[model samples]
Each structure stands twice: as structure tokens, then as C-alpha cells.
Target: MKVLIIEDEKELSKSIVEYLSEENYLCEVASTHKEAMKKIGIFNYDCILLDITLPDGNGLKLLEELTNENKQDGVIIISAKNSIDDKIKGLQLGADDYLTKPFHLSELTARIFSLIRRKQFNNANKIKQDELEIDLLAKTVVVNSNPVALTKKEFDLLIYFIGNKNRVLSKSTLAEHLSGDFADMLDNHDFVYAHVKNLKKKLSEAGCEPYLKTVYGTGYKWKG
Candidate 1:
């Protein structure tokens, strides 16, 4: 999974990035609202941890920008502002969830997982498509009732593909999804092909169907 942490507090953002990275999520941090805007304008994430109060802008206005762009990226407000009005405005503008500061990272992680599931997998802990089964919480994949071993990056790639099934993903987008915004700093996306190749091999060896498809010169897609 991919997440963007938008907060001015260095310690909080650092802690979030560390915890979520340990949980197999690619995370990017934006200390200011302008930085957050730049990242969101360029890349899409599975979830965004937005702080309502920023040094440069209001997070609610960011929500409005997201709504205006019709972006489907899931949003969760992480703010110290506990007023009902702020929560209402955030939700009214389109935040999936809100967590007050001084909150538990575990709880925040749970909410993020829930939001991603609700947006991508229909709120099901286990996603099934034909002979393939994925337990999102367990971070496991089974094909034809057989467990498939995948590296962390490989597993993340699989989920990214499945969540965006049938959509043609470009190499750059895949790179960003797998490597966070650092993808922009890379010169080539050979790592993307490597990960996809490994994931495909593991799935095929596990008696899985040919769900991963390469788009010639473009990228890859998951087709049911």
C-alpha cells in the first residue's frame, strides 16, 4: 500500500512513516501544505493522512481540491482540531475518516487499512477472484488453495495490480506506487519489471492463472 503523510510536525510524520513502512506501506511525507499539494497533484496514493492545520494551508481546502479533481484516493484527517464542525466539514468535503492527534498509531493503522479495504476490496478482509484468494490483513496470497511466497515488494505489487484490475498502468505510475514519490528520482523503471517478473513467476508456479498482463511497451495490468 501507498500513503502520504501531510503534517508540519516532524516527529509525528517521522513516526508515522516509520510505522507504516514497517507495515509494508510505501510512505511519503509532506511538511507543508504546498508540498502536499505538489505530491497529490503528481501522484495518487492508496491513503492520505492529512493534518487539518498546516503551516501554509488548511487541510479542508485540500480536501476540496481533491473533490474538485474527482480523485478517488482515500483520505483521513489527522488533526488536533476536535471540533464537530471541523469533522463535519472534512467529511462534507470528502474525508473517509478523521483521527485526532495524540491518537494511537495502531488505531490509525487500523483505520487506514479499513479505508483502503473499503475503497478497493469492498470492505472484505479476504478478496477472491477465481482461483486466487488474498487475505489483506494477513498479507498472504493463495492460488488454487496453495500458498504463494512473495517478497514484500512483490506482494505490494500484486495488491496494487489487483486493486486496479483491468486498468492500464504506466511504468512510471507503477514505479511511484511501489517506490513512493522517490520514483520521480529514479532514472529508469527496471525495478518495476523485476518485481512484476518475480511476482508473476511465483503466481504461475503456484498454479495461478495468467492474471498479470504486460502492455507491450507501456506497463502491466491485472485482468480477471
Candidate 2:
């Protein structure tokens, strides 16, 4: 999953990024409200850790913008303020959860997982499609009761395809989703083709049907 940490405290942002990266989440940080808005305008994150206070503006304004844009990203407010009014305002602004500054990283991680699950999978930990079974908690994929060994990128690619099944996905879209902010530095999407090829080969070897289809002169789609 991808996460955006909108925090001004450098140390706290670093710690959160390190801890969440260890938990297999792709993380990006924005210290100011302007930077946060830029990132939000360009990329789609699975969850956002929003701090109410920022150098440029209040995080609540960003939340309001997200609501106005109809963005589906799950947001969790993390601030030092514990006042009931602030909490109520944050929730009313459409935040999924709130965490005080002096909180455990483990608890924060659990909250992100819960928020993503509720938003993406209807709170289900396991996703079963035909002979394929994916355990979101375990981060494992199995086909026909046999394990499929997929690299982290490949697994992420598979999940992305499954999540948007039957929709035509451009190479640029896949590249941006996979590489996040770094995608702009990339000159081409050769890596997208490579990951899709590897994923298709692994699933084919595991006796699964060819659900991934390539659209000539366009991009790719998951027919599942």
C-alpha cells in the first residue's frame, strides 16, 4: 500500500516512514501544506496521515479539499492537540481516524491497515477470486492451493490490476502507481512491462488462467 505522511516534524515523519516501510508500505512525506497539496494533486495514496498543523496552513483545509475533489483516499489525522472540538472537527471533515502525537507506531500501523481494508476490501483480510487466494495480512498469494513466489513489485502490480479489473490502465498510470513521486524521473515504462510479464509467467506456471490482457497500442487490463 502507499501512504502519504503530511507532517512538519522531521523526526516523527522519518520514524513513521521507516516503521511503515519495514511493514511493506510505500511511503512519501510532505512537510508543508503546499507540498502536501502538490503530492495529493499528482498521486493517489491508499492512506494519508495528516497533521492538523503545518507551516503553510491547517491540515483541515486539505481534508476539505479532498472532500471537494471526491478523492477516495483514507485519511487519519495525527496531531498533538487532543481537544474534543478538534477531534470532532476532523471527523466532520471526513477523517477516518485520529491519533495523538505521543502514540505507538504499532498502533498507527494497525489503524492504517484497518482503514485501507475497510476502504478497499470491505474489511476483509482475505481476497478470494476463483482459484486464486490472496491474504492481505500475510502478504501471500496462492493459486490452486499452491504458493506463488512473487517479488514485492510483482505482488503490488498484481494487486493493482485486480483492484481495477476490466479497466484499461495506461502504462503511465501503472508506472506512477508503482514508483510514486519518482515516476516523474523515469523516461519510459519498460519496468511496467517487465513486472507484468513476470507476474503473468508466475501465475501461468501455477496453472492459473491468463487473466491479464495486453491492449495493443494502448496498455493492459485485468479481465478478472
Best by TM-score: 1
What pairs collide in candidate 1? none
Could you give candidate 1's per-residue lDDT for residues 57-165 as a string of tens digits?
8999999999999999999999999999999999999999999989999999999999999999999999898999999999999999999999999988888898999
Residues 94-161 of candidate 2: C-alpha lDDT, one tens digit per residue = 99999988999999999999998888778999988898989988999999999999999898888788
Every candidate's lDDT = 0.92, 0.92
Q: Model 2 misses residue 142 by how many Å?
A: 0.7
Per-candidate TM-score against the hidden true structure: 0.98, 0.96
> Whole-model lDDT, candidate 2?
0.92
- Model 1: what TM-score? 0.98
* Worst-scoring 10-residue span by lDDT in model 1: 176-185
Looking at model 1, residue 191 earns an lDDT score of 94
Candidate 1, backbone clash total = 0
